[model samples]
Target: MKNLLIKLLHHNTRILQILLFFDLVILALHLTFGSTTPFFHLDFEQNLSTFYQSSKLIGFGMIFFLLGLSRQVKLEMKSFILPLALGLIFLGVDEWFQIHENIYRVFELFEWLRPSKVVEASMSMGYHSSLWILYYIPLFLIFAVWSGYWLRYFQSKLKTNVWVIIFSGLCFLTVLLMEILSSTGSYSGATYYWLVTVEELAEMLLASMLVFIGSKILSK
Candidate 1:
């Protein structure tokens, strides 16, 4: 039994399956109990949020491990590893604190940052006018510039790297686009639950994919 457990632990695919199983369980509980009830706030308090944070931490650890390994690989790879690790660290911090949301409130304090017609339209449609332009857009631009510098590194292992990009892109799309649509007070009942579920599921899949990609890199 111990040997079986150890073997499973060493298999990254199995590990991801276990994580997925837990996510499903949590989702089931949330749907059954509702978000406000203590029985299952998993979507917000325990499951999705926790998994998202854990994935960022795992990314940080994987990058750090790769940093050490890169020293023996090549100079260019070694140089890329540090910034990548730092970026993961920043992501972990951001996930924990929801820094972007806070930044939005800070922007809201300034009279000059009044809501635009688009923002007004979104709010009128039952969505939040959180001003993505003020916070998330700028942060995304910075991330894009940083990632652009390491495009070659990402393409180093083409297949796994592409999966990484695909999953990561999906995560951002859900967070930036799907989330906005869901927040619009327009969605209620089953539609609302399904929308939020998809958003959280995207996050979990992205994190799991990153872990799988990291494991492949480590094995190589």
Candidate 2:
């Protein structure tokens, strides 16, 4: 049991590192290229844009996982700075691309946000300032951190579970196929709204590669 646990940690550490590295690169691109506009148009609030924007913070947690996997450095301000700086670059480039290409993307700065307040006031709830930040900022952070841990946990648990791994691999492939099908504009249903953009798919793959490759090198 002890040896099995050790081996699982080892394998998971490798997988997590690679995922984090790739996630960072994708995040950089996301920050650089921007998320799809459909995401931002959430009626009650949730949408693709929110997913796109929020995923970047997950990228940060990926970096933290990488640090833990490598075990070369402790988490600190200096360590955190690079990901944040890289993240800024990611957002900057994305915003620039949208503007330059006239891609019908809207850039909403933090100040311009009003959806939550509207939702609360409309619901007749008292405005809690903490709720505002909690809804947006810290929520993303908690999610990102937990997601990083979860990925590592999943990888560890499934390392030797080949059938489960294959199933998940197929599911990811299915997602790609659906995205391709939806891109044709023929599927005008609710599922179409959930379809992954080509950009998002590409970023996911790219980020996965970064995580895999970086961890492999560091682990060696």
Candidate 3:
């Protein structure tokens, strides 16, 4: 499978170009038709754009899994790659199923495990905050730090702009932040719609960036 990925991506110029082009098309659609229309918009869950973004993450995860399988990468690198692959794929599934939001049920089922008033009060900051963010943010920080750990490897191997990757993670985190803000009713009406649209579109764009980076690294 690693060999197949290498063979397919060794001639990657056009594929990356097409993927980047799709990124722009998605953005245009989200801002125009997607923002106005309910059927295909990104702001709503269970929509096509949402599915595409989630699937993109899962696919990128597979690319990393293949890279981990490759004997070409150093053993220490495989240790990192395997976890990243699992994280991406799991997050994709979480997006599709909303595992983070649904975790509220778990706390309900197991009351003892739920956050104490102290924790919730500390997290609240005088606003009604979603409990999911309470659980997810620490996990998110861990993932972000783990991802950032490999920048030196990719930067040296692909000679790619590390900022692009950093920016992608920023965009990804922005989606999370915006969701928290949205749930708090910090913004609503058109402001809410546009903020969600932009952040979700940024997320889709980030997914594309990772796939491109993974492909680039494999091609090298």
Candidate 4:
């Protein structure tokens, strides 16, 4: 038991540092560009959508990389391509959903769907405002692939332990707490609740699995 514990400690120190660094970057980004200043002004709707859409997508990428890092299954182009397409589809769907009930935003393409004469006569501003995010799809895809590559590269470089697990749990819990707080109020005309409890549960399970596997492999 003594040797085992010591081994765990030694192995996890480096991995823990890496995790901490990654977390710092995540927090810093949110603070710097996530709708508003971190603690002082929390815009629920704006920040919630921002965090959920961006972080969850990034997390999806991380999961991809972690699964690849495991090396239990072979990697294939089709595997990544399908999920990437699915991710973009989900993003597009979510963007469409945002337009619902928000009078400030409009469905820009409906004008085009109508006859050109009707559009010329109508006073509607036929511009799709939310489509700007579509430009980010490629960047997000690259980030996800990079995450997987990094995991595989670092597979043999770090160590993990119970402390590391605790740290990871805290990271996941912080995200959940932030989401809860962000979802509690209204911002930019959208209100929501914990609608997908099952999905959240699955995320927690996957996160735990990542920590467990990382610890097992890195432990001396």
lDDT (CA) per prediction: 0.59, 0.42, 0.73, 0.41
Clash count in backbone of candidate 1:
3
Output the worst ten-in-a-row residue range by lDDT, candidate 3.
Answer: 110-119
| lDDT: worst 10-residue window of model 4 | 190-199
TM-score of 3: 0.83
Residue 106 error, candidate 2, Å:
21
How well does candidate 1 score on lDDT at residue 181? 66
**Window of ten residues with lowest summed lDDT in model 1:** 1-10
Model 1 residue 170 lDDT score: 72
lDDT of 1 by residue, 82-197 (tens): 55556566666666666654565665666666445446665577657355533567677876776565555556654545756666767867766666667666777678778777
Q: Which regions of candidate 1 are displaced past 4 Å?
A: 1-15, 35-39, 42-48, 55-70, 108-129, 132-134, 144-153, 160-164
TM-score of each: 0.66, 0.29, 0.83, 0.29
RMSD of each: 5.7, 16.6, 2.7, 13.3
Evaluate model 2: give its lDDT: 0.42
Model 3 residue 165 CA deviation in Å: 2.7
lDDT: which candidate is best? 3
C-alpha RMSD (angstroms) for model 3: 2.7
